[model samples]
Target: MSTPELQWFKSSYSSSNEPGDCVEVATTPTAVHIRDSKTPRTAQLKITPSAWARFLTTLPT
Candidate 1:
């Protein structure tokens, strides 16, 4: 999808030192935008806020 208007934000946990495997996120009124930090200009995977929350909760700390 064309995400020309989404204001993307990188995870605060991301470190410049660890450049690889980083992800960027954008929050819209209806959905969340997720993209690779290494390739910010590429297409993003959009999901609902509830789905995003569920996905995050499944991550191991």
Candidate 2:
């Protein structure tokens, strides 16, 4: 079986000058996927879009 491709994007908050420290994201209608920018081939964390929204709400200012 062949693995499907996903479009990943690094967080805008991540400094552009340093490409090493960032988290990549890929979103679909069903879920939001995340992975370390330093390691793209590894397993990504998959979460529902609602869950992702809730998570972001908890971020400290």
Candidate 3:
């Protein structure tokens, strides 16, 4: 089986003034994908949903 193409979107927190300094994300049933918005065709990072949640908790709000 093959996975479908990911639907990437820029981060909500991305500054409109700094378009090149942004990140994009896509979510699948098993993993979350992250990549630089300026370089979508480059390599991306993948992590489990649970791991993503843990990472979010570590961020300062």
Candidate number with the higher lDDT (1 or 3): 3
TM-scores vs. true structure, each candidate: 0.79, 0.85, 0.87
lDDT per residue (tens digit) for residues 1-61 in model 3: 9878899888688889998998888999999999998888899999999999999999999
Best by TM-score: 3
Q: For residues 9-54, could you state the per-residue lDDT of candidate 2 as single tens digits? A: 9877899899989889999889999999999898899999999999
Q: Least lDDT summed over 10 consecutive residues: which range in candidate 3?
A: 3-12
Estimate candidate 1's alpha-carbon lDDT, on a 0 to 1 scale.
0.86
Q: Tell me how many clashing residue pairs each candidate has.
A: 0, 0, 0
lDDT of each: 0.86, 0.91, 0.91
**Position 61, candidate 3: lDDT:** 94
Instruction: Kindly list the per-residue Cα lDDT of model 1 for residues 1-61, writing each as its tens digit.
Output: 8757778777788887888678889897789989998888878899999999999999999
Report the Cα lDDT for candidate 2: 0.91
**TM-score of candidate 3 to 2 decimals:** 0.87
Clashing pairs in 1: none
